[model samples]
Target: MKLVSLITAFSLISGLVEAGNERKFTTIQPDLTEIRKAQATAQPYEFKEEYVPGKVFDRFYNIWLENTDYDKAAGEPHMKDLRKKGITLTNYWAVTHPSQPNYLASVAGDYFGLDHDEFVRMPANVTTLANLLDAKGISWGEYQEHSPYPGFQGFNFSNQETYANDYVRKHNPLVLMDVITSDETQLSKIKNFTDFEHDLEAKKLPQWSFITPNMTNDGHDSTIKVAGTWSKNFLEPLLKNDYFTEKTLVVLTFDENETYEEPNRVLAILLGDIPEDLKGTEDDTFYDHYSLISTVQENWDLPKLGRNDCGANVFKIIADKTGYENIKVDMDGVYNNKSVEGWFSDKHIPLPPPHCCE
Candidate 1:
């Protein structure tokens, strides 16, 4: 009876109860028609070119480290290894005040005036990179360490005795987006780190992956050295594995800087299957979190989001792939004037039009 009860509970949780004695799995693949309907409602934007020949990458992986300054990361041992094996962006800066905005900007092109890390929910109609990737049939998923389960909606999960945050919702940006959380099928893709190892071993990695280490490993409640060592241990083997490296690109970056007074510069490295000639080189082009969005779109021949992505610089490696010339942007002209001042305040206003090519 206990066994039967456990099975019944799982069936209810999965919405796949057995009919009579035979069990049948329900089809929960993403609804293409619904995706198209939602995408049609988004504001249209044009790509710079009508067509691009081939995609630069077969897979994309992003690993976001926590609040780390550019100077500190330069001295870390793992970062040194990355510098030797990959290209580093010397002039990369975080877009806004805090962690949440930077994460949101990476996927949504605009932070939408977010100045704080409060628990705010995005409206369902707002289009995100997930929508764009799904529209093109490109697979995407987020792997968050210490998360309770796929589609867990809690704000924070902590170990009982220590009271230290293991998984914080603020760090996992996809759960805040309604488009991903509204559907069980989409939400299931936002899984814990254990599933990541399983999927990797099974060769079921998605085309685009957003990975966030737990608070300790991500340096939220720890030091950059801890995060760096954790990253080295976790990523070194994957970097050496041909199964994971072939035609794959992995970006390692921090969420924001520690001090608000200094310019929001963070360390960013492009590793994994980097072009032979460009390896161990540095690109000083000015870029922020939005560049991640632009680079992905450029690589996959997808349309721009028309937010900061329109004005953002694509990664030089991707530019080399698409056969396009790289252009530098005047960072001084860009401003963050859309949010009210306060750590917990929620008064967010719309940003002015982007100054593309200015």
Candidate 2:
């Protein structure tokens, strides 16, 4: 009965995801302006905990953008300018196609074979990077550009006037995992950009943060140029912000590549309190979505997820700072263009149990 019920739930979730493609968001106003006005009334929860220092950096911030091939993104005027301010990850690859899976993999160390941008949720038993950080009393949060409110579980909110995909659930990694979504306290930490502003001003930002801009700003609905411009404008001022950058590691990266036929390489820029000699440099070491998890774990000595993160390379800079050697991957034919079968996939192959201590 337990096994059957679990399978039934997975099938139902898959059905809802397929049906959600055309469904208008009912919880929030369909009009983007009205939605923003309404969301203003939602109290943004302020959470601040002890700053657990990591080996290489005190705080880590990752800003995620949308689809753009490595060269296309790297060649953008604003991106090029940003590259000169920090280390450019020349060989960093995304884990898979579409977008959401890469975000999921970044925190969970695996995407469980999800293939598309769908309204799916993981079971409560599944844990993520948050748990690892929580275990060590480290603080973390996610700031999504246009999320209606903290702890929102809607499929996709759009502009009723333009019918554009605005704040999407798929782009927000923590929302997909039930481990975070099920807990009200954890959900409060998954806030919008407005909350980010409040936190930033109060100097109450978490030790680790995952930031995702709106669909348009992130280039999902626009071009790489727009995303690059938005990224530079948003991150440039923080370079001198004392509260934000003392021994901090800021990463600018994409969820996945725009081209499905090519390898899933994306342009990533490393900045914020980096060693001066490493700035304006290019690191060609092979990396993927799992590298995000590995890098965080390496810095904080967090427990292994016992999945892909176990084998993923830590950020070379973090490795060098912490005296940990990063592994070099031989990328001959590791093209993660399509996802395989799992609980969320159309095939609905049951997901394996989470290996907490593998």
Candidate achieving the largest TM-score: 2
lDDT string, candidate 2, 1-358, tens digits = 3423554575466555432233122232246565577566656557657788889898989999988999999999999998888999999989787887888888887787677776777778888988999999999999988777887767777755787888888898998888998888888888988889889899999988999998999998899989999998998889879888898999999998988998888999999998789889999988888888889998999988776777577888988778877666667776778664455654335567654532
lDDT of 1 by residue, 93-112 (tens): 88777788778778877666
The local lDDT score (0 to 100) that residue 356 gets in candidate 1 is 45
Can you give the lDDT of residue 2 in candidate 1? Answer: 42
- Relative to the true structure, how large is the alpha-carbon lDDT of every model? 0.73, 0.82
Q: TM-score of each candidate?
A: 0.79, 0.87
Q: What's the true lDDT of residue 218 in model 2?
A: 94
Best candidate (score: lDDT): 2
Worst 10 residues of 2 by lDDT: 20-29
